[model samples]
Target: MSLYNPNRVNPQRPKRIALVIANPATSSSTGWPVGFWWSEVTHPYYVLTEAGYEVTFFSPDGGACVADALSDPNDASGYSRHDLISQGFLHTPELLARIANTTPVQDLVSADYDALLVAGGQAPMFNFANAHALQQQFAAFHAAGKVVAALCHGVALLAFTQTTTGEYLASGKTITGFSNQEEDQADQAAWHYGWLPSGQSIMPWRIETRLQEIGANFVHAGAWQSYAVRDGNLITGQQNFSGEATARLMIEALGR
Candidate 1:
């Protein structure tokens, strides 16, 4: 019998990744300027780019996207003061240049990239949830057996996404997002808006509930656990503190 040669390399080209950012939008609940969380975008941008994967930025509506006010270096919240990853992106001219100019999501089709990264923020809860166009785009990418990663509120999109086969995309996947405890802390600190109605309890509005409703195996590991979970090619991070670890996990999943 002929010897099998496992060392043979395929002629296919190397894969490229695209970072999909939420277009700048205002928070309906809080009336605050909101966009993708800084660390969620920057940390992953740094990770994927350094892995030598060509990364392109895009927004749901296509245009310049802003970072959340709390994520801004000058924000009074000071909640993200210890985020060196975000600070580095703020100061790095090259990375800054990339974000300063982003393409619209409609401009690029699923064929343009090997993977799609959905960055999160309070903005997604308001805008991304109802963005049918964006949900379709992500479903397309996931159906192709390509990687799909989302962090914090970014995973909110998964709650409504359906595969081309018409099944809930997250139906059997394990995922995580911003926890109820974090929401409580943020509301207590900012007081601009409460995610739950008075006496409604945080349980109903938790991302875990939404995912569970869609049949996902969900996990919530307290506030700021630096927890990132990978299921198949679908990756998710708990919240802001999990950004770096999430990025690293994405890098590992992409094998780049």
Candidate 2:
């Protein structure tokens, strides 16, 4: 018989991870209150939890997360219709509660977990950039040789985060995020993103552009394909499709 039990719940194993999210914020381009992406959160959450790691949701503002309507798997636009993983998460009362009430990111100390995963959404463009506490957390986790995973726009956190040596976190890191071509593809689509007063893209700066500017070796595959890269313990996923890929890498890194 195998010593491991897939159905066993190890309550005291001390294997915990934090999923960080952005509080609701206005999308500069669309003017909508944007929060976490459904697939970016649910897909990775599914993979991590099924692997038996205790996951906790954290937010800078500490409250309920509002889904980007376009990312809702059941949304009428059908943009994310194939996202049955998220569809199932939406239906789980207990799982749904985790996203509905997030613990404040500030309340978490470095000793609280083994790793951290940042979730993507339009809100990150508004808030995750240059947040001191978050940057510190990134540094702390990486310094501890623990996994630091970020997906989609959430990867933007590394663009401005720094090491104690005062270098940008992306300085020598190989990372990926929402790519430029993909953004251009979205721009040309029929989706109704809010127009800026200047009639330009609502996001003042692009995630890929900022990452490159800060010296990260950004990489990507096809326009909408799932792509994730692992550099040391730093893991980054390109977009929604990359979430589970990133999570799997983290599972290996955690040795779980």
* TM per candidate: 0.85, 0.91
* lDDT, candidate 1, 1-256, per-residue tens: 1122232232144446677778777665545667888888887776665655666788787767888877866577686787787888888787677787887777777876788888887778877777787898888887777888889988888888998778899999988888767877765644445544454332225577788888999887887788899998888999877777887787777674
lDDT of 1 at 254: 67
lDDT of each: 0.76, 0.84
Q: State candidate 1's TM-score.
A: 0.85
lDDT of 2 by residue, 156-205 (tens): 78877889889997887898999998887766563454333333564668
Residue 183 shift from truth in candidate 2, angstroms: 0.8
Identify the candidate with maximal lDDT. Answer: 2
